[model samples]
Target: MWGPHLLLGVLVVYTFGRVRCQFQYPTETAGKQYQVPQPPTYKPPTNPAITGIPNINTVLVKPPPFLKLLVAVLYGYKINRRIKPTPPIKKCPEGWFRRDQRCYFFSDKKTSWYGAESLCRLKGGYLAIPDTEEENNFLKETSTSEEVRLQGAPIPHFSRWIGLRSLDGSTIQKIITNELLTFTDFVPGHLASRGLTSEPCVHMDYTSSFLWKVEKCHRGFLYICERHLHFEFKYIV
Candidate 1:
């Protein structure tokens, strides 16, 4: 519905945007930087003080020049109210993890179940272990977004390959409901130990929320590499 008020607001916005382009651009000029003198903490006797007064005792006390200079520089730099920080695309950048409110880059690409676990050790992330509901949600959301980006691709979606495997029953354990999470829409039974088609590695499938399938770990697929980066994430789920 095109209301009169809405039409007026649109006109104002268009005028504002058009008017901004009229501002003049600056020519390149190298500005000269000036240095300031620092005050001395301890002063030696100045050359020949007159009339019983020592210049050392009369010395002025001032802060270090750099400190004052730094303050002045900061004051000169305007904080633009119109300027805003760019929102990051994802918590754990492209091909990364938002685990436990922290961003990690899992460097391990593709390997067998044992090899994947070893790689996590080499890079300091023990597979993609989500310990809390918040963490599980964050990972789920992050993977879902990644899946959206990877839409129409052959592989559904994958974040990281865990050490747990369907072929190797002794090593694999059922991921707890509250803690166990998937990037793809994972339900309870679709992928509970079932990727045993040919290759025996189990990785979560992002497209199927209820499925975690097994694949050949040796073959290289895009992996969510993890490095324990300390960047924090604010979970919004």
Candidate 2:
């Protein structure tokens, strides 16, 4: 009887030990809850060579509205200065003959000395005053050609009023320019003083090779007008 009991007790002790070992070390199963320790997360090391370099982000930023407008204005002004510069005016207008940097206009109609001056003023000019022999010759040739073209015949005894006049009926000078008469083409023994009392105004006798002759201021005669050449730029848009 003691041997059977002892055998039974030994069997019981071995079976309990086996069960406790199985409980401590359980087997992996399909429906068991378990927490696995994750391995250390892998991280790539930073490069020390490029660590100090500036970061270049390609973000596009817009300029302020006023700054953009100012830049546009400056660019436009530069282009305009290069392309549309102001030009100087240096030529005579139409119907006015240019000669030695001056302009001349001979009239076909006759008028008194005062009327001639007033007409020249209306035409943006003054009574023609010949300052040199070349200018006198130019006036002579131009007048002769114009007269011949108008009448179809040579004028044998015609005179034209000039800018020379004796202020206070004494000293002769160019009335329009207030310049002394440095040059004169007077006939011999027929100087301006000879007619100072009767005629205060001077005239050019085209028949006598454009010689100077004093005449009455009230007398009507053809006249010449003079002006300076001027030019200006005009945009043609």
Candidate 3:
């Protein structure tokens, strides 16, 4: 009995010592507080200043070549449209006979050939030069009319001095214009039959149907003068 009791007391003592040692030993996280994980902070990026940029309000750009030419043409056309146009020519003056851009005047008084030419020059004209048969007919008709108007009034002679004259007693030429007398109405055989002793100037015979005849330049007769009609243009303001 004493041995069994002694063994039982020794086993109880060993078990109590093991339990107290376990309570006193430190744990892996002993005396430390638990913490939540923290999030990362964010930062914005910065831009650097540039030195060579131009301002939009101050910038100037040239137009294209075609656009510039088009603008210039339009401006020129506008200016041209504002300019005035020229007017047409006017009619001849009063008392002047207008015939194919020319004017004719018949004298009302008798004068020598040289005197007649001087009168024509004073009036800014020359002795008439009949270039065509029609012109010659006109002169003849005018002379006939003048004689008929006279009603056989007595005069020194019934003839008119024409522009034709023999410069060297051979070739007949117009003294006023110096043009050759290409047209003539000399009576048949009258020029060749005239005696060579007398110097001759041309005349229109009013007494015998205005036939052309050679006469002395010193003889007094009525004359005709001719000149070009002047033209002028009128304009609007």
In candidate 1, residue 48 scores what lDDT? 73
lDDT of 2 by residue, 29-66 (tens): 43677667699998856877656554445222555444
Looking at candidate 3, what is the lDDT of residue 111? 70
Candidate 1 TM-score versus the reference: 0.36
The predicted structure with the larger TM-score, 2 or 3, is: 2
Candidate 3 structure lDDT:
0.66
TM-score per candidate, chains pooled: 0.36, 0.55, 0.54
lDDT for 217 in candidate 1 is 47
lDDT score, candidate 2: 0.71
Arranged by TM-score with the best first, the candidates are 2, 3, 1
Best by TM-score: 2
The clash count for each model shown is 13, 2, 0
RMSD of 1: 25.5
lDDT of 2 at 3: 100
lDDT of each: 0.47, 0.71, 0.66
At residue 220, candidate 3 shows an lDDT of 67
